[model samples]
Target: MLGSMAIRALSLSPLDSIAVVVHPDDPLDWLPALGNSAFSASPSAWPSIQVVTCTEASQGMSFSIRCGLKALIDDNPKLDAVVVVLADQPFITTGMIAELIGYLSERPELDYVATATDVGGEGEQNAILMPPAILSRSMFEVLLQLEGDAGARKLFGLPQFRGAALLAADRTTVFDVDTPADMVLATKQILGQTYIREHRF
Candidate 1:
């Protein structure tokens, strides 16, 4: 699943590097699996792809975020920003990632660009702000301060952080695979179904 996500991200022309953060429990298993995947099989594959293992993954998502961020920063000290993508979001596409990068690139004032979903209402309902988010170097310190299960979404509420939201290309693009039902829905979406009868509103 993560390998597919990596391939999608790497396919984008705007991205210069990709770091896949794996859990500590099965680092050995994941490393070999990803290396043997189709993306890594090609002789002309990008050399920027790196596999990082989060030693503190058991603590929560923050550990993984820290691991990936540290590796990226160490690899490229001049990195302008990073696109934090979730591997479980199989529906995310290169276009969506390019949109986020484009938004931030065009607006130098904004600290970050995140995806938002409209839940459907008369006024502005609580928007779901999340990844594939682009975070500038200015936000790196704050991001490292995060702990536990808390992620970049928590930073959206901070007044100090100036952020612009991009409407997701579609609901499916942001739909992540967590539960068995979500897996079923993602499978249906992958199969080219536009609507799920059981989930129609």
Candidate 2:
């Protein structure tokens, strides 16, 4: 349900399709909002989401990404492009999703694109976006063979794949639900502070 809500709040357009890759063992607390977002999104142009859950999801993020990418390519061999998103990022509103899709739609020449917020640091800020371009099926196969916790860093470095990082106006776009504290915060945002106290703890 948490992921569904994430989908509903996304800025979806007629031009793009989204592939939501979730871990089979995703926390129960995150379900309601995600499900709500996905089901509540504008039905007319609602993205075709392929829920790819793998047993190896317990392995790492890369496994999940590879599973999702493989599913997307296998199901829709002609998939033009896909927005690789995280189900746990509750703050990413639908408007942000639309903006990213819109930017990519206007410029098809770019292999892939991502949105990031500046996390103030010493010299420069850290940029985070969905990794590894999902341009071709061959690229996805290569991703499936990848190992460890790395998402798609090496794949993006290849000459054939090009990417762009959009500076997010709202930094909340970069907040990802990765730990117990993150779950508590996300639950409050989705189900409200009062609800958390009354139900989720």
Candidate 3:
């Protein structure tokens, strides 16, 4: 399962608890299978994960984020922060997840740390901050206040928020499956076809 690959990446991260948020229409039963598969090849000390069904997922991405954060908080009140990664990003790896967590860890003052895209220019205005992101618990309340399609990145612009941006090392690492063409490429990568990856730029 493609999502299993994504979950495997998360399972390998240095997290205490993991929560897989499923939408209303998704097969909630897949959670167990995915979790088992994810941890199969993971380290023996891999974190245990629970599946959460976001009933209001149809409302917006904000709902999914809220549901996921709440689940994680409930599972472990002492949880200091979380790294949010989209399941559609099949190419996401354990190192990428670790890097984001490490970046935020190195700077304890950070409210959030996210993948940054440099739109070929200078300065902060030319940069765009997106997930997968590490959000400190201090910023959780603000995320709960988000509505509509606004994601965690929306909170980056809030007044006095201290967020860091890790410039993405490769476009493939950020490649998200949003279209049929994307799925085809993801399939090619999954099958170990090297040409597509070598020429992805």
lDDT of 3 by residue, 1-201 (tens): 567778777887777778888886897554555546335464567787878899998888899999999988887888899888888887777787889889888999889998877787764568888888899989988888889988888888888789888877776777788898989988887777457656787
Q: Which is superior by lDDT, 2 or 3?
A: 3
Best by TM-score: 3
Rank the models by TM-score, top first.
Answer: 3, 1, 2
In terms of TM-score, which candidate is stronger, 2 or 3?
Answer: 3
**Model 1 Cα displacement at 140 (Å)?**
0.4
Candidate 3, superposed: residue stretches over 4 Å from native: 28-44, 121-125, 193-201
User: CA lDDT of 170 in candidate 1?
Assistant: 77
Model 3 score (lDDT) = 0.81
All candidates: TM-score: 0.83, 0.70, 0.85
lDDT per prediction? Answer: 0.77, 0.61, 0.81
The lDDT, on a scale of 0 to 1, for candidate 2 is: 0.61
Model 3 residue 184 lDDT score: 90
Worst 10 residues of 1 by lDDT: 34-43
Please tell me which model should have the higher lDDT, number 1 or number 2.
Answer: 1
